[model samples]
Structures are given as structure tokens and as C-alpha cells.
Target chain A: MAGHNESGKKKSSEAANDLQTFSAENLQNNMKVIYYSQTFLSIVGGVIAGILGFKGLAGFILYFLIMAISSVGLIAKAKFSVHSYFDCWNRIIFDGFFGGLMSFVLFWTFAYDIVHIF
Target chain B: MAEDLVLDTAIRDWVLIPLSVVMVLIGVLRYFVSKLMRSYQVPDAKIVKEGQVIVRARNLRSGANFIPPKAFRARRVYFSNEENGLLFVPKGQAQNAQAQMFSDPNMAMDMMKKNLSMIIPQTLTFAWVNFFFSGFVAAKIPFPLTQRFRSMLQNGIDLSTVDVSYVSSRSWYFLNLFGLRGLFSLILGEENAMDDTQRMMQMSGFGFDPTKSLSAEKDSLDIIQHEWALPKFEQRAEAVLRKLVS
Candidate 1:
């Protein structure tokens, strides 16, 4: 509780570094895997959504189901407390957004493509 | 006889030859274009930044041997990064070094073994890329970068520390919305020098203002980020919970 006590103004990373006393420059070397995996999944999601466009209701439900599941995952991540005091703040927040937007996307795809397909 | 011969030549040579050529061209072009546009590559010169956080020491064993003191409690949670997770320090780095040296190996091993299956953040991890990115990307338009961002939490190397990175703008907006500056102040016992960052971002709109120009904004998918201060999914989760709750 007494840690991270320092300056009153600076960049978030710099401010955090100042509190650490020791700098932790997290260097990630391989990021292609992460990006490709995401893009691939999006395309798959897009394709499935394209096929399911045949059924108006089915299309809606499919995206809704995925997004709903994701949002729940976000809530879980946020509420999950690894530490009592200061939690992994960004972790909780990103989980929430990723889950929320994907759910929205899945449903939106159906909504947008339904008229075209059916 | 001439008209019949002309018809035969049209089918065998003129029509079929061109048709086959066009089909092959279309097929080859599709494959090449897909490969080119499937995903953008990270430039070899592009640098990937990362970091880690050690956690604080909680209830440890008190016995003579390296083990949880007779009352060692199963730790409920761990630091996102164990090295940087030390929220409180009894002494300084010197004391921590001593503790680490004398700690029981078994206990450390026990801590290392995690149920990784539970933490697997696969496709569902960012479930709503379908919602925002679907629309934004479908239109091939950029949008405002308002969502919570996640950088490499663990660089997956060295195993010494788990790295975490996030956008500065999201952090500022989060704190401002939930009055979290106070929360940070409360826990840290003092404020770090992060006050000026948000003001700078806001002035520039943190590079997120679709209304300002014809240029596109970053939609929700820009960084695949979210914030609890912005609604941590509990409200949206009512529908999803039906399976378990029912």
C-alpha cells in the first residue's frame, strides 16, 4: 500500500516507472502470431456470418450468442481480483472491451448482411 | 459448309480458350490478393515493447523448513506479474533478496504450476470484434480509439516477469470517470506524476475525433481494449448468465 508514491505529474508509463525505482521495459519480440490469429478469427467470424445470413433470426442469434458469451468473460476478468489493493487494471478493462465489441460485431454482421443475403 | 465450320471453330478455340484463360486468371488473382491482404505484417524494424510486475508477499509459512508456516494459506490470487507485484515491501530490495534465497523450493514450484486451461483467452477473448470492427472494418473506415487496450501482458519469455502494457488515453479516461485518481492515491499512499499525460491527450483528442475531419476514427477494435469504469460487462451479462443462473 505504501508503494508507487512519487511525483504528481508525468506520462502513465513514466509515472509508473518512477514509482518502480527500477524500469521494466517490456519488450515483446514476436507479435505476428498474435495479430494473425486475431485477423484470422475475424475473417472466420465474418465468413460464418456470411453463410448464416440465410436465416435472419439465426444470424441474429449467432452473433448475439458469441458477443454475450464474450461480455460475460469480460465481466469475469474485471471482477477477478488477483490483488486486493491495486489490481491488473488494464487487464480487466481490455477484457471488457474485447468481449463487448466482438459481441456487438457478431450481431451487427448479421444485421447488416441479412438484407443482402435473404 | 463454311458457316458450320465457323461455328465449330468458335466453340473449340475462340470461346473456350478465352473462357479458360479468364477463369485461371481469376483464380490466381484471388489467391495472390488474399495472401497480400489477409493481414498486415509487422515490419522487421518495428519494435515490440513489454514489461512485468512482481506481486507482494502474502501469508507465508513460519516453520523451520522451507514451507508455508504451519498456517500457510492457499493464496487466493497471484500478481499479474510476480516480480512487479510487490504492493508492499517490508524492507528494501536487500530484505527481498534474502527472503527469496531462503524460501522453500517446493512452495515456489507449487506457485508456478497454474491451471492454464482456465486462463486461455482465445477467440471469445475479444468477443465483440464482431460488433464494432465488423461495422468499421466492413466499411474499411477508421474510428475513434475509445476502447481499453491490451498490450503483451506476458512476453512469454524468460518466465521471470509477466509484462503488461496499456494505452495512456484509456487509463486517463478511466481514472477521470470513476474518480480513480483517488483510488490510486489511497492505495499507493501518494500520487505518481501521471497528471499531465491526460491533459496532453485530451488536447489532441488522444488521436480520436471522427467529427473533426473526413479522416476515419479508430473503432473499438483498434487496440482490443475495454474499461470497468466504462461498464465492465455486468449490465450486458444478464443475457449470457441465463445458462448458469437458470
Candidate 2:
């Protein structure tokens, strides 16, 4: 029984290692899709926030809201079996969140200044 | 709160609009210029084959348990066989390969061209922005920032009374420089040369040494103890089905 348990532990560890192994090309392509989608959505969100004259905290809240909705949309698009496509839930939800933030703020400020300030 | 300064609408038309348009155009131009400058050299056949071999070994390592024991042993023998395996590299040749790469004039020239492509336009743009659009406030950010951001947001403007959220033209150029990466990725495809950050990272020597990775793959492949898991999976499935039926 002890030997069986040891073998089972080894098998489980090997399975874990197998799960970690992903095709680099596929992983890169998945990341690229997420990045592109986040960029497009964040820009759109920034434009909407600017048009609606959303203030400081409200604007950021809207950005996060858009990101959350995008994550949900991605999960739905994957048919809710995200592990088949991505390595983890974080890859689907938060992989490119910060990368998109700069573009979001840039467009946010641009639109805000254009419509409301200037 | 202090009285909000009313910026002239002319600044919007003349400075803001033109600055952004020119930056976008320049970005597009840089993309095409770099593409034209890039000389596509056909990689050596040996290197290609070695890379493919490494990939195959990696795949086998990952999927060893899925294949039958006999098949796994045959593949492992084909790779890790000490006498004449594909991964066996002569000690002298491996050292020569890296030294050959470093000594190649074409490689140096290629690096120089890439550096020139990145640097020339960057310097020119910085000079142009400084020459044409310096010394005035261009636009105000909607979000409030702390006083620490005064130097960054208010570049080329030296007013103690001005809020940190008021961006000057030079700083706007810098902002647009970093912020337009997403726009460039949208316009150009995923692998375009528009990102200076990526280019800078590349310049800082993130080179792939094939020999190092090849040996690493070989070592990992050497240690895999193959145990076919299919029979275990089949038994588990049968037990589960029997439980359901009973």
C-alpha cells in the first residue's frame, strides 16, 4: 500500500508537469489575441468614458468594468472551458490587463481633453 | 481648487491635432522603412534541422507517458544514443559554432542596421518635437495626479503654480510615443517593428543560443522514465462505468 501511494504521488507529479508543458507558438498566439482584444476594448471604453464625462474614480471603475466584461466574453467565447485554450484562469482574465491600461489612459485623456476640457 | 485655465482652441487644432497625426504617420513610416531595411537571410539547413530535432525531443519528453513503452524507448534511443544520436554534438564543433556566430561580419552589420533604424528616427523625432512644439502647455489630463508627477507631465514648462495634470507638448510627444503601441499593433499586425520597447529589449541581448538549449533538452530527455498510462486510464474508465451501471 505504501509503494502504491508512492507510485501514485509520482504519477500525479508527472501529470502536473505535463499540464505545464504548452506549445510555445500556441501560447504566443493566445496571448496575442488577448492583447489585441484588450487593446480594442480599452480604447472603446476610454472613448465612452470621455464622451460621458466620467470623473477620476468613475473613469477607472469603467475601465475595470470593461476589462471584466471582456474577460467574461473571452471565457464565453472559449465555451467556458478555458483550460483547453489557456494555461490558467489568470491567462484569460488578467494576462494583458496592465498592458492595456496605458493605452486606455492615453485615449481617455485625449478624448476627455477634446470633448470636455478644450 | 484654483481657477481652471482656458487653453486656446488653436492649440488643439495646431499643436495637438498635428502632433498626433504626425506621430502616427511617422510610426507607419518607420514600420515600412524597417521592413524595407530588413535583409532576409536564409538560415543554414543544419541549424534548422537542429532546431527541429530539439523541438521533437521536447515533444517526446512531454508526451512520453502517452505512447507505448516500446515506441517511447525507440524515440529516446534515436535522440539520446551516445554513439550516433542526433543530439550528440562534438565538443570542438559546439564551441566553434558560437565563435563563428560572433565573428561573422554579416551578423554585426545586421545588428548595426537594426540599431540605426531604431535610433535615427527616434533622435530626429525628439529634435523635431523640441524644435517645433516645446515650451507650452498642450493638453490637460482628466485624471488628477499627485505632485510627484509634476516633472514628468509638465516637461518643457516650468511653472510652480501649474497643476501636475497639465501636459506640455514635449511631454505629450513622449506620452504618445509609449501609448501608441496598442494603436500600432492594431494598425500593423502582431509582429510589426513599431514597438521601441521590444527593440530596446532585443538590443539588450536576449539572443537564443541553440547549443545551450540543445544540451538542456538532451539532458531532460535522458532522465524521462517512460511508463505508459493508457492501461491505467482504461481500467479507471471501466470501473467508473461499472459503478454507474450497478
Candidate 3:
């Protein structure tokens, strides 16, 4: 009985020392990192749009369509974990979609005018 | 309105390429400088202990309901004891002492250092772009904007004829500052603080200082009412056990 109590105490202490893993805090941070990567790629897309001289609605439509395809590719790359993709849908999908729009316009202008305009 | 406005090829070679290069280079430079400016001060042991005590009290308040009431009372008694309860610090004395500790002069020094590092590079780059790349309208945005945005987007050029969608070199620089968060994180790893977009949010908090975070946590913890959670817990447990057995 004494041995069992000692082992139990040891286990409780170990649990105390261990930090919370897979908590809400960690999930939020992972989403932020994913958002960061998405924003980066979206700017690259803008640059590409500029280089290719795509304009107005045509470029805008193509940009999102490409982002959708890339998002699917990302899902596949995550070993088909569809749940992870939807975990932070607000940040990963909607925010990334809109937030990327500004930078896309910025770079798209620079690239398009530089390549095609003057 | 996909108007085929003719642009000279020379504008691309001179203005667009240089703007892109300068923006990327400045971003890289700012990343390294900010990293170098970051200060790591070891927090006082007493402060750490105080914070941990509150956390323990919090855990007990929430989760002790799972244990028997006797065990819960014992833990509560240990924390709420008159002589040395974890939460029983003399309120006025503790607050005064913490106010002193939180007002450490090193905090101001650290803030000054951080501001200098962030500002100096940014100002220098802004000046450089203004001097070298100010005259040219670098690119036209794919979408339209309001006339009001012309002042912002078309900074250097003073032309009513230029479409509101066209952006000058100066506006492009500002756009790149917020936009390249991805590129920096990709090159330097996700943990890097190179991008200013996040920092911009932090700065807009205005007068909120970093040193007050400890005291703020304490203040938040102090306000929590810790009614014990273990009363009638055994009855609930027994009902569950009986249900499972049946």
C-alpha cells in the first residue's frame, strides 16, 4: 500500500510538471502561422498577376480560383486532415481571402504596370 | 474597365524593379535589426512565485470539485489560512511593492531601445525611397478606388488625369511594409518578428507598457471569487457509479 501511494504521488507530480498540450491557445497560434503563410503566398500571386498583365475582374477571379486550388493542395499536403483546414475557418479562409486582396492589388499594380504599362 | 493604357518599358526597368528590390532589402534589414534589439531580462523570483501561487489557487477553484469535499476543504484551508494563505497577501502592501517593481527604470530603457531600432531603419528607408523613387507612378491597381484614395495611393504625382487606381512609388513602399509579412516569415521561419504588421498592432495600443502585464495579471486574479467546487461531488460520483454498475 505504501509503494502504491508513492507511485501515485510520483505520477501526480509528473502530471503537474507537464504543460497543457493541444490546448485552445496552441490551436490559435497554429492558425496564425497558417495565416502568415497564406498571406505570403497571396502576395506572390499578386506579383504573378502583375507579371502576366491580368486586369480587373479577370485577374480578381483568377486569383481566388487559384487560392482555392492551392488550399485543396494544402489540405492534401496535411495528409487529408480536412478537420485541420476547417479548425480556424475565419482566419484561414475568409480573412486570408480578404486580407490577401489588398496586398494582391498592391503588387498586381506594381507588376502589371511595370511589365505592361510603364 | 480594362483600358489598354500604354506604358513605357523604361518605367518598368527603372521604377518597378528598383521599388521591389528596395522594399525586399529594407524588410530583410529591419528583421535582423529588430531581432538584435530584443531584450531578454530574467523576471524576479518573488514575482514568479506569486504568479504561480495564483495559478495554483485558480486550478484548485475550478477542478477540486472532482475530489472529495474533505480533500477540497484541506486544500482551500491551506490557501486561505490567515498567517500564510497563498491569496492572503496584505492587499495595500503587496500593491505598493508591485507598483514599485513594475516601475523599474530598465523597462523605459528597453522601450527606448526597441523604438529606436524600429524607427531608425524605417525612417531611413522612407527617406531613401522618397529621395530616389519619388517621381514615378509605379503601378496601377487592377481594381478601382474612390477619388479620396488618390491622395494616398498617388502620393508623389499631383495629377487629376491619372486614374485613382494608379499608385505612386511612395504608396507602394507603405503597402509593401504591411504586405510582406508572409515573405519574411517564409524566409526566416514562422517564429521570426521581422514583419512590422504585427508590431504595428502592438504599437497602436498607445500608452500600454510591457512592464504592467505582471501587475495586470495579478489584478485580474485578485478579482476572481473562489467558491469551492467540491460540495455534493461525492453524491454525483456515486450516482454515476451506480448507473454504470446497473
Candidate 4:
């Protein structure tokens, strides 16, 4: 416990010099940006899926699969240094994923009906 | 299997395309409007001083272990000393500063502007969508939804024969409002005020509250029990050196 405490102090001291810590608000703001981009991609994905006439489960699956690819692109944008990203945003990636999934259905259905039925 | 009802091509040109375009334009306009409405206030001196005092105390606690024992002892004594210590100096200073910030007329005015900027565009767009595109079931969901969402998703349209999955045009506008955060970020960059979802959350008291945060910081600082880590540093360093020699 003492050794852990010392290391904790050392890390905090380093953080003290650095103005920005991993505060909740900062993390939320960063996650908001990530979520926004993901939602955009998901909407576009839904539209493309709709245009192709993929319906029901197939459409849902295809939309999420496209989102997973975007996640990979995001990780690659960070040069696969996921530890830093995870350190800053642990739960946010999942939140964005699920949130994107919900909206993907909405846009996917809209585009599909508009394109296929029209 | 249910028979698919064919929609006219003009539906896309008239409803879907126009609604999508309007949603994007409104988001862009809201971004610029909120930007114009932002209030950048000069930070108060006492707040800055209080922040500095806390940071200095934190630095003393964390970095003291790295310094020699004599230096560490001096800093510890200076900081944790009861009567004149930096940590406890003017205990309610942060509280008063935070209170003043909350009560500042400029802050209240800025908040009003922000709220107005968020509220006006939202109400206008909602009213416009409702006025123009009230009854059209703009889209049909591929998957099934519960009966509860029937009223929400298909707000203006109500048909017993129509499945609950069909969403009205106004709901589509609302959905686009929430879903277009990425487009806003793409066009205006991150941190734009085009995020209506986030703005609503803030207005509803879910987002950043500065005064509460200030008080929380003060509370955490109050309970901090500083422990000196320099007393056994030499022993640890000597052990590492011995290991290297061996």
C-alpha cells in the first residue's frame, strides 16, 4: 500500500505540472466528438444499406459491421496506441457504439423505405 | 409476409431530401448562432489565486518524495502548518469566489443568451416541421418496436392498419437533430454548439456545473492527509544500486 501510495503521488505530481487532467467533463467533451463522428458514419451506412435493399436483421448487422470498421479507423487514427485512448475514454467507446446502433436503425429504415419503396 | 406499399418518387424529392437538407442547414446555423452568443468573461483574480494555492499544495504533497529529506520536511511543514499553512489559508475564499461567479450579472446574462440561442432555433424548427410535415409517415423501421414508442415515433400519424414502426416526418426531424452531431463536427470542427442534444442536457442540469465542481475540489482538498515519502528514499535507491553492482 505504501509503495502504491508513493507511485500515486509521483504520478499526481507529474499531473500537477500538466494543466489538463483526465477530468470527467473533458472526457465527456472528447467522447461527444467521437460519438458525433460515429453517428454520422452510422447514418451514412444506414442509407447505403437502405439503398442496397438490405432489410430487417441483415440491415442491422450490416450497419453495425460498418460501424466496427469505423472503430478500427478511429484506432488507426490513434496509430493503434489504444492504451492512451482507453485511459482517457474507457466507457465512451461503448456508449458511442450502442448509441450509434440505435440511430443507425432509424436512419437505415428511413433511407431504405425512401429509396426502395419509391 | 406483409405487402410493401410503393411510394412515389416525388416523396423523396419533396419530403426526405428537403427535410434532411433543412436539418443540416439548421444545425449549421445554430452552430454559428451559438458561437456569436458565447460570452468570454475574464476570470476573477481570487479564483485564480485559490486555484494556484490548491495546485501548489498538491505539488508539495506529490513532489516532496522526490526531493531530499531536508527540503521535503521544510515544504511539508510550510504547507501543513495549521496557523499560516498555504493549504488552509482563508478557508472560505474559494467558496466566496465561487458564489460571486454564480451571482455575477455577466454570467447570468451570458447564460440567458446561451439558453435563448439554444431554445429559439429549436422551437422554430420544431414548429416549422410540425406545421409543414405533420401527418406523413416519412419512414418505416425495418425492425419492430414496442407499443410505447408508437406515440413518440409516429407523432402526427395514427392508423390502426399501419404498423407501429412507421415514424412521422416531425420525428424524423427530431431524430436528425440528435444524429447530426457528426456532420456538425465535420463542418464546424469539434466543440461547436450545434450539438442540440448536449445543449438540452446542460439546460436540464446534466452537463458541467462549475460552482459544484469548485466546492467538490475544496472538499477533497480538505480531507487530504499529506504523508512524507522521503524518509526511506535513500534505502530504496541504495538497494537499486546494489542490485546493479551485483
The most accurate candidate by lDDT is 2
**Ten-residue stretch with the least lDDT total in model 4 chain B:** B206-215
User: Where does model 1 exceed 4 Å of error?
Assistant: A1-40, A54-61, A67-118, B1-246
**Rank order (by TM-score, best first):** 2, 4, 3, 1
For each candidate in the order shown, give its overall lDDT on alpha carbons.
0.28, 0.79, 0.64, 0.65
Stretches of candidate 3 off by over 4 Å are A1-22, A70-92, B1-6, B54-83, B98-103, B193-246
Clashing pairs in 2: none
Report lDDT (Cα) of residue B219, candidate 3: 51
Candidate 2 TM-score, C-alpha based: 0.87
| Shift of residue B69 alpha carbon in model 3, Å | 5.9
lDDT of 1 by residue, B1-246 (tens): 011111233332332233323333433343344334333334223112111111122111111122332222222122212243223222344444435434635433322221121122212322322222221101100111222222211111223221122112222122122222222223222212132343344345422322212111111112222221213234335544654698
Candidate 4's displacement at residue A41, Å, is 3.8
> TM per model?
0.20, 0.87, 0.71, 0.71
Worst 10 residues of 3 chain B by lDDT: B205-214
Best by DockQ: 2
Complex DockQ per candidate: 0.04, 0.37, 0.27, 0.28
Who is ahead in TM-score, 2 or 3?
Answer: 2
Q: In model 2 chain B, where is the ten-residue run with the lowest total lDDT?
A: B200-209
Tens-digit lDDT track for model 4 on B77-162?
A: 66556677555445555565556656778756766787788789889988988898889877777777778887788888877567
Q: For residues A1-118, what per-residue lDDT tens digits would candidate 1 score against the true structure?
A: 2122221222122212212121122211111112222323333444466544434455446545544443344345334432221224443233333433343343333333333311
Error of 4 at B94 (Å): 7.2
